[model samples]
Target: MSGMINLIKMELFRLVKSKGTYLTILFVVIFSFLLFMMSSSFGEQSKANMLEEDNALYAEITEEEEHIKSGGIGFVGVDFTRDTDIKFETIVHSFLSSGVFLIFCGIFAANTVCNKYKCGFQKNLSTYSNKKWQLTASENIAVLAFTVTEILLIVFILLIISVFYFENFRLGSAANIIKYMGMQAVLYYAFATLIMFIVEVVHSKVAGITVTCLLSMGFGSFFFNKLDEILKLNNFLVTQHTIVYNAKMLPIAFDGELWGTAATVAICSIILYNIFSAFFVSSRDMA
Candidate 1:
């Protein structure tokens, strides 16, 4: 365990030295913040609209309570029908915010895995200990580090927008944002692992990344669109089972079989991928 952790630390240090990676993350942060700020304005307005409903559902609930002088058995919950509308507005704004941010996360994953090999770090990394097991471990560590850093950074970006754009931030809504963040994080983690191995096998960084993005968007949507049947293989896909850990965002409920199957697929693919990729690094002549 200690050996693995130490190796991971070294991997993180190497990533820190890459100017392109830093620039990419920073650029994404700026872009996400700007977009979030814009979207949050709408969210704030929606919240305000909810407050203006004094003569709306809440008021009706009050009137109902007065009339229910019958045994104190008032139908209070049914009176808040407008809560449904507020919930929908929140969902719309959240979807927009998440969509924009996830694009950057996918790109970031592509860059981290693809560029690491494209730039010749793989061969250099092997010189220290080229054993396939060790090599795979190190690569996984590197990708994990990059993944965690970018995810937390994205969360911070959203927090900034929530504060600056919202007129009055409600503590309860924070869970929603957290949920989305966790979902994206889990999905992207699988993506990074899958993309790294996939491209490594194909031996074409650009080709691998491109195919991944297409498949993720195209197939992932299909899975979501037809959850009753399509959800059967979600765990196998890695993109399917991740639920964001936020209060404001709706939680995702995944089938256990789907997650188990997808996880197995990804795990097996990762093993074979490292094996094939090992040949290129261990055998190739490095500069």
Candidate 2:
């Protein structure tokens, strides 16, 4: 265990030196803040338009009170702030579940593994006294990378909240954000394992990274939707399962079905990846 811990520390050190790893975090943070600002601006524009429409409608209603008095087509002011409780929850959710962001996560996973292979780190590690300890350390390193990504993500999210809606913040909602980020970390850990499996099987960085991009970018969704149309296997897709889980993690009423599906998919993905990786890494040439 001590050896594995030491290896993890070394892996982290190597990760920091890998410029691509930091690029991933940089991209996620910059794009997340951009999206937040754009969405907030759009929301303000929409609110102004809605307010204008409300005034016009109210004038029409006063001029035509007989219709409203007949209990038909009454105008209540549009509640622009109707869903304010879920505002911050939504900003975090939308950014996390965005197709572009997910693809970046996939790229990050693939690149982390690719870097090890390209730099001959994996081959050297395979020569260690206990191969299992080395592999475990590597996987733990990927997990840690994903955890760090989640931390950066949450920090950016809260930064946005602080800028725009700090007054509306409640401890309960903040707790929910933390909980959702925890779920995201778990999902990303599974994803990193799957990417490692891909990297191992393909034996080429380009192919592995391309496959990761394809899977996370909703091409998988298109194929799976077609399959579901023909055979109803929607729940079996890991990407879809994660999307469902992310959507359900919002500050709203909980749905057992969504959480169950997400949990099942996460567990199955981890188990299957570990099993495949154990066999593939052990039997394949490390050269």
Candidate 3:
């Protein structure tokens, strides 16, 4: 127990000191700003287009009474217009469902795991402990901790940006946002563990990074979707069972079924990856 705690502490200390950690956080901030600008610009253009269409419709209506009865000349859709009340929860959903967050998390996990092997740090750690599984457990716990921190950072940055961007921005339902973020955090932890498993098994930084990039970019989900089509798995898409797909499908508004699905998938992935990682670590010689 002490060994595991010590290992976790060491991993966190290294994470705090690593340049890549800060670099990743910086990239996330820059990306968030760019996303907000692009989304806002698009929203303005969409609002303008809607106004033009509404004006043209009004010209054809011929009667003010008829126009007023016809929904007041206002357009309704999913586009984020200035008239649309923006919520912090909605912004968070957009940012995370973009898949960029997962990509960054995967890359960070790959680097964190691979760097130890690159520097012979894993071997040195192994000499002090015979229980290889403890190392896997500790590193995974540390990475998951970092994942939660990153999620919090992302929410904070987005909240700040939304406050300035939206005319009447709202914090939305606190309980809902907490539930949504909690679900995403679990999914992200699973993703990080999967990346760590790949890095540990391949034992090659390049290969691990390549695989992580592909998976993070949704190639793995694409392949599964294709297979479901080819195999004619009706009413059961293999893609829907994947972490990437779940992350994308997770709604800002809580849905019981989706929440259950996300929880099951994340928990199963975490358990399986940890078992596989521990098995490989125990069987293989670290040096």
Report the number of the highest-lDDT candidate.
Answer: 3
On TM-score, the stronger of 2 and 3 is 3
Model 3 residue runs over 4 Å out of place are 52-83
Q: What is the C-alpha RMSD of each candidate to the true structure, in Å?
A: 11.2, 9.2, 7.8
Question: Considering every candidate listed, which one attains the maximal TM-score?
Answer: 3
User: Model 1, 261: alpha-carbon shift in Å?
Assistant: 9.1
Least lDDT summed over 10 consecutive residues: which range in candidate 1?
A: 71-80
lDDT of 1 by residue, 1-287 (tens): 66566667776786788776688688767866555544445435545666876457556544653433211221111111222233322432343224333444446555665676677665665444534455546766676666667767766665554445445543345555555455445555555656666665555767665655444334344444366465566334333332211111223333365444444444555465556556655564443
Looking at model 1, residue 207 earns an lDDT score of 66
lDDT of 2 by residue, 161-249 (tens): 54465446534466666666666666666666777778777767787678666655445555655665777664464335544234223
TM-score of 2: 0.73
Please provide TM-scores, in order, for all candidate models, with all chains considered together. 0.58, 0.73, 0.86
> What tens digits encode model 3's per-residue C-alpha lDDT throughout 1-287?
78878888988898889998889888877876776776777677756766778766444433532322222221111236455687777777766765667767887888888888888888677554569898889888778877888888888888887777678888988888888888899998999888889888987767767776676555676578678889887677777788877876678788888888888999999999999999998998888
For candidate 3, give the lDDT of residue 281. 86
Tell me which residue pairs clash in candidate 2: none
Kindly provide the TM-score of model 3 when superposed on the true structure, using C-alpha atoms.
Answer: 0.86
Model 2 superposed RMSD (Cα): 9.2
